[model samples]
Target: MATILSLSNVNKNFGALTVSDDVTFDMPEGQALGIIGPNGAGKSTLFNLIGGTLAVSSGTVQFAKQDVTRVPAAERCRMGIARSFQIPHPFVGMSVYENLLVASSFGNSGHHDAKAECRDILDRTGLLPKANRPAGSLTLLERKRLELARALASGPKLLLLDEIAGGLTEAECHELVETIKGIRDSGVSIIWIEHIVHALTAVVERLIVIDFGKIVAEGEPSKVMADPLVQEIYMGISVDDTAA
Candidate 1:
């Protein structure tokens, strides 16, 4: 598989605080990579840099073999890179279908049948039945589904998901896992930042653990979770603490 996205020596700073420090990785085409980390680990900041929502202080971001380090967020969407925010913020007044239509229009670039594309996205995301309903009236699960649907409507080749499964029941999360698996099977590469370990393990082929703006482990999901450093981060207790 060819490298679809590459982050080399990427660094970001907010005044004296370093959010991302020398972060680097290569994501292959059609691969689902799961990113797990504690709060304030800079996971969201890393997504901002990749999606062009924030400027990198150093290093580079390449997508589909093109250097997009300086590209604007809208342009990145046009280039087949789309992201779903951790929080769902759909247009409160618009119908579910209309929300997706807005995304399709913004990222169309005259290449796809936007109408058909929106319909397909609705179907894939299990939102077709609610197409004409107001987005703000939906339940939490429906809202998250709509968020994923809106991102898919843009026809992205690389999708960045930020804590998408944060607030959901086990059954709802399982439903989402299946939906994401279908998307992965359709050849869209995904980088999902999720705290729900079970959901991430269900769909991703590789796992990456980040702490303090740097990678501490990468490889198989189960193995990485069992790593001492990863365990420490999640358990909130160090090895010494356990020993004592």
Candidate 2:
């Protein structure tokens, strides 16, 4: 498979602290990759670097065969990279449909039939019933759906998901996971950073574990999660107690 995204020798430094250190990986086109780590593990920082919300202190970010290390966030969005934040912060005063329209206007750029596009996105994200509801009135799961919908409004080729399953009930997480599976099956590449192991494993083809800005493990989900060191350090459990 062709590579859709690649990070080489990536480093992100804040003053003297290295939040992302020598990170390197390649995402296969149209495949889902999951990232897991404990708190303060620099998972979010890695996402920011890929999504162009933060610049790499040193290294390269190549997406769609183009070097984008210096690209601005909006330019990256237009280049078919779009992401949902860890927290859903939609335009609270706007209706769900309207919020998607706003996102399409900026992120999609020059797309026609915007209404139909957004409507379809709402349906895909399972938010069609709440299309006219104010974003603020929706529940946590609904907000998360809206965030996913808004990212789709941009027509992304690569979607970076940041802790999207956070704070969801089991049933709600299942719903979102199914929706994400639908997206993945439809051939959109994904890199999901999530703490919910089962939810992440359900969708991703491969898993990478990060700690203190470095990847401690990378391989099949079961294999990585079964590593004794990873199990002890990240999950705080010995390998014998549980199997991934």
Candidate 3:
């Protein structure tokens, strides 16, 4: 598979504080990658760099084999990169379908059939019944689905999801896991940063564990989670935790 996204020796800093330290990775087309780390581990910062919301202090970001380190966020969106925020920030006043239409127009360069495309996204995200409801009126689970739907409306080849499954009941997370699996099956590459291990493992082919802005472990989900360092640092578990 060809690489759809690549980060080489990436670094980010805020004043004297270093947030990302020479982070690097490559994501192949149509692959699903899960990222797990402790809070304040710069996981969201990594997403910001890839999504063009933050400028890298050093290193490069390449997408679809093109250098996009200096590309503006909107241009990156037009270039087929779309992301959902850890916090769902939908347009409260806009209907669910209307919000998707806005994303479709912005990300697809005013595609003529934006409404049709949004309808499809709503269906895919299991929000068709709430399509006409005000976005703010939806429950937390519904809002999360809308966030995913809005990103999908952009027709992205690479999707960056920031904790889309956070704050959900077990049953709701399971439902989201199935939806995400369908998305991966449809051939869109994904990088999901999530704390919910079961949800991430259910949808991703590989797992990467980050600590203090560095990749400490990466491989198949089960193996990565089982690593002594990862289990100790990120999961805060000992071998006995598994045995128990």
* Model 2 ranges with Cα > 4 A deviation: 109-111, 237-244
Candidate 1 has which clashing residue pairs, if any?
none
After superposition, which runs of candidate 1 have C-alpha atoms over 4 Å from their true positions?
108-111, 237-244
Model 3 over residues 45-102: C-alpha lDDT tens digits?
Answer: 9999999999999999999999999999999999999999888899999999999887
Tell me the tens digit of each residue's lDDT in model 1 across 1-244. Answer: 8999999999998999998989999999999999988778899999999999999999999999999999999999999998998878888899999999888888734536788888888997889999999998998778888889998888899999988887788888888899999999999999999988889999999999888898889998989988988888977633433565
Model 1 TM-score is 0.93
| Steric overlap count per candidate | 0, 0, 0
The candidate 3 region of ten consecutive residues with least summed lDDT is 235-244
> For model 2, where is the 10-residue window of minimal lDDT?
235-244
How does each model score on TM-score?
0.93, 0.93, 0.93
lDDT of all the models against the reference?
0.89, 0.90, 0.89
The C-alpha local distance difference test score for the whole of candidate 3 amounts to 0.89
State candidate 3's TM-score.
0.93
Per-residue CA lDDT of candidate 2, range 31-109, in tens?
A: 8999988777899899899999999999999999999999999999988899998878899999999999987988845
Query: lDDT of model 3 at residue 26?
Result: 92
